[model samples]
Structures are given as C-alpha cells and as structure tokens.
Target: MKKVKQFGETVEGYNIPVLNEREIRASAGILYLLMFWSWILVIFKDSYLLLKYANMIFLAEFIIRIFISPRYSPFLVLGRLIVSNQTPEYVGAAQKKFAWAIGLVLSATIFLLLVVLNSDSFINFFVCHTCMIFLFFESSFGICFGCKFYSMFYKEKAHYCPGEICDIKAKQAIQKTSTLQRTVVIVFFAFVIMTVILFNDGFGAKPTSLWLIVKSAFSK
Candidate 1:
C-alpha cells in the first residue's frame, strides 16, 4: 500500500488509526450521555444510590491514569503501542495528549454537573438536550461546534495538527462500524437516552422524588 506523498516523495503505507479530534469528541459525547443515565438512576426510585459513588470510581480511574497508567506515561504509552515502538509517531502522541487533557476537563465538568445538579430535569434540559442539538448539527452540516470554540482559545488552533490519518479515514470510522457492532452500539445509545428521558419524567414530579412498581408476591 505504498503511496506517493503530496510532494511526490515515495512513502510506505501508514497503519490507519481510528482516533482524531472528531472521533475523540464523539466518544466523549457518548461518555457524557452515559453519565446522564447514571444520574437518571439517582433521580429514580433511589435505587441507584450508588450514582454518586460511580463518579468516585471515575475520578479514581482518572487519577490513576494520570499518575500510574504506563499507556499514558510520557515516553512509554499511546503512540508507542500503535505505531512502532522504535519510531513512535510524535504527531499521534501529541494528539493523544491533547485528547486526554480534554477528556479530563470534560470528565470533571460532567462530575460537577451530576453532583451539583442532581435534578433529572436539569440534566435533561441542559446536558442531554444541548448535546443532542450539537450532535445533530455536527452530523448534518459537517461542522464541529467544539472545534470552532476551541480554536478561539489559541492563535494557530485552526492550523492545528490533526492525528496521523487524513480526513478520509477519520470520517469513515466515525461514520461506519461493522453491521452487528453498529446495531449493538445504536441500541445501546438509544436505550441510554430513552432511559434518561423516561426515568426523568417519572421521577420529576413524584412526591417522594421516586418511582416504584408494586409487584404481587406470587408473581415472581
């Protein structure tokens, strides 16, 4: 799969990697959606009293990854695993560092959003609704709302280095997965969103701030 460079220089094939800014954002978006579901359980029959604890687990993971995960260690991880260890791609490594930094910030924001605004109504109205709108706009117009805002922070941001792969590979993986994996992925996200919506509604107006199902002893 050797190919000529833009400058007409000969180069060997690059192992196509799946990650880039868009895919990274999309994954963070999915994780935030999952956080929405975790909060939903807290708002429901109080069955998920552990929702708060779940945040603790994630916080611990982040701390460990930052301090202990070799995959995240400066000279040991990420690109070294993907691209050859001998010539670890600096571009890929830099992109991963940026992505991880953004993930940490996003994760902290989500944790605060859940802890401070435990109300299901707030999560549905602000987090879920806003993210859904952003995602739809991105998918429809090929515009990255976050990238635009992120660019405002730095002068050369617009000309920033995207990960190793070109636009073609990024879009392909972002758009498609194997059929069965797609089905499962679609169903999983749909279920999370619907569960958040339904449970939010059911718990929003309850006097005890909870919902319960009455079951006959013999039914089970």
Candidate 2:
C-alpha cells in the first residue's frame, strides 16, 4: 500500500503494493477459463463429481474473500489505476467512474444472458477462451477491450484528464499464472477427479455421485 495526500485532507495508511499484473491477469484469466471447462464436464462429460468438488473449492474461496478478507476485491485494481503511478494517460476521475458503470453493466449483461439462455456454449466460450485471449493480449501487448470501450464512451470528457487517484507511488501489478500453464493444470486435475468418481466402485453409494446408482439402489 502507498500513502498519498488528498484534497483538503491528509490521507495516509491506505496503500496496496504493485503486484505483477501479468501474473494476476493470468491467474484470473485461467480461473475464468476453468469455469467454462468445468461446465462442459458437467454437461457433456457427465463429470458431476468433478464439478461438485470444484464448486466446493470455489465456495470456500468466496467465503474467505467475502467474509474473511473483504478488502481483497480485484476490482480494486481498477480503483488503484485511478491513483497509482501506473495511471494510464487517458484514465481520470470521470473516466474511471464511467468505466466502472460500463464494466459493471457489461458484466451483468453477460451473466444475465448466460443464465436466461442456459448458454452452455457461450459460457464455455467465455470461460474457456474469451477471458484468456483478452488478458493475454492485454498483458503481452497492452491491449484492453475494457479500456478501449471506456475510452470510446468517455473520450471527449477524459481527453485531457489524468485520472491519478493521488500523487502516490504504487506498485506495478500482480501476476497469477500464464494461460498455458493454468489450462494444463486445471484440465488435468479436472480429468483426474472425474475419472476417480466414475471409476469408484461405490460411487453410487454417496448422495451425489452416480445418480443412476442411487436410483436403482433405492428402488430395491
């Protein structure tokens, strides 16, 4: 975290280190891709066990973030961009606010459509490929669709504004893992878990494993 003086107040003690953007993007991008693959396994591969267990992990992580460490929201990254040293030339107070609105709406629309349409393919496409492609391009070439969209919508308003939150020296970025690395690891792990569930001799005995087994076992 970095400290900076703000308008009419001595703001201090609020600073977040510059993490490796490459890694952070990669990590998030991979997780998003994994979500799609997990969905595929659930629908086409009949890998219920894998999906169930993976969801548990997700739930646990969500609990930790939402309940335990509420301040670790990745969206803060955008907020940081507003005040950090790495503030983009085009971003400013108004642009950041605009970006927040647009980004939220875009994301909500995506989620809503996916749910209402039961969009297996579209969800898979986004989780498995879209996010990765976008993040990869951003990390490697500094291309960002979110950034571009914000620019287009707020170009005139933010043309001369430098959206630096404060005159603070913040860290660079946070990097997770690379796309290739995440894909290989996540897919392999999912496959293994599915295989175990499918092959387990008594998988049907459990409440959630092979539904067929539970159905027949109960019939008798």
Candidate 3:
C-alpha cells in the first residue's frame, strides 16, 4: 500500500524522493495550452462549456497528484511518454508537492466558482490567469513559481530545483546577459510601441478574402 501511495520515485544517488523535471515541464505545457484554448473560447465564443470541462479535468488531475500518486496522473503519464526519449532531469519532490498543492487549491476554486456555483467574477478571472502564468513559466522557462514560496512556508531549504536555482552560485559566462542585450530589448519594445501607433488603423481593418478578390478580378 505504501509503495502504491508513494509521491515520488526514490532514485539512487538522490537523498530524497525526486521527480522528472522534464516530464513536469511537458505536463505544464499541456495544461497551459488546454487552459489557454478554453480561455480563448470563453472570450471569443462566449462559451463556458470547454472552460468548465477544463476546470473539472484540472481539478481531477491535481487531486490525483496530491492524493493518489503523480505516476497515475493522466497528464503526467502523457508527459512522461512525450519526453521519454529525452534525459530525465530529477528535482526534489517536496517542493513540487507544495507547488502542486497550490495548484490543487486553485483548480478546486475554479471548479467551485465556474462549474459548481455557475458564476463568473473577477476572482475567477484572476485565478485562471494566475494558473496560466504559473504553467507558462514552468513549461517555457523551467521556472516553478509556486516552488518559490516553499522556503517561506517551510524551515528547510528546497533541493534539486529545476535549474539548481536553490544553490547560490555565480552566473556562468555564457549565462550572463550584456548591457547591449538589455538595451536591444528596451529598443525592441519601443519599436513595437511605435509600430502599434502607426499601424493601428491598418492592422484593425478586416482582411479581404483572396479567393473573392481573384474571382472579382477574373469576372471584371
């Protein structure tokens, strides 16, 4: 029973239980895309059907992660399959459990408000976006936003972070960003603002169908 209920794998050379960070990121990416698509449908189509389903699924998955086992979580299993060919990057399971507890709370809140209660409000919007941001950072940058709070709540320091971020180490030469890079990023945003200002009207105009234009030209 203990074996079946274990939270993480006890791999050799690791003092504590650990999980595959690669699979975690892959799972985060999958959830992020799912929630983003449902959000788009909500915004454009005024449909809550997909969003509600997403919330239910999200809630169930997190419940499994926290209560049952990460190994049995459907999305995690899928993520493992997707990244099976790649090398596994092991990270401490304790911080991940804490992080996923936050996820469970957020998902449950969303399910309650949007699904069970059948309501909408700023709270729902805020929480949904918060989840998206968490998932986005985890998947895209290998950063765990929720894991950042582990140290605050617990006495012990987090171990084996995705990028060894828990350790205090100087940045490598290759990892350092130069002043020119910062300047270029700032200039790029400035250029983007100018572009929007100049092209607002043109960009807002509805596009014409190419087939319609071709047909009209041939007819003429």
> Which candidate's TM-score is highest?
3
- Give the least accurate 10-residue stretch of model 1, judged by summed lDDT: 1-10
TM-score of each: 0.35, 0.34, 0.94
- lDDT tens readout by residue for model 2, 105-169: 43444444444443545553454344445545544554445544665754453332222323345
| Candidate 1: residue pairs that collide | none
Q: How close is candidate 3 to the true structure, as a TM-score?
A: 0.94
Which wins on TM-score, candidate 1 or candidate 2?
1
**Candidate 1 residues 1-220, lDDT tens each?**
2221111112244333222334333433444555557658756865444555555544554454444442333323232433342432222222343334453554465567665665444543454345445545433443445544544555643323343222334455766678899899999999999998889876676454222333443356
Q: Weakest 10 consecutive residues, lDDT, candidate 2?
A: 2-11
Off by over 4 Å in 2: 1-27, 30-33, 36-103, 116-132, 156-220
Ranking by TM-score: 3, 1, 2
What lDDT score belongs to each candidate, Candidate 1 first? 0.45, 0.45, 0.96
Q: What is the lDDT of residue 163 in candidate 1?
A: 39
Best by lDDT: 3
Against the true structure, candidate 3 has what lDDT? 0.96
Q: Which is the better candidate, 1 or 3, if ranked by lDDT?
A: 3
Question: If ranked by lDDT, best first, what sequence of candidates would result?
Answer: 3, 1, 2
Q: Give the TM-score of candidate 2.
A: 0.34
Model 2 scores a C-alpha lDDT of 0.45
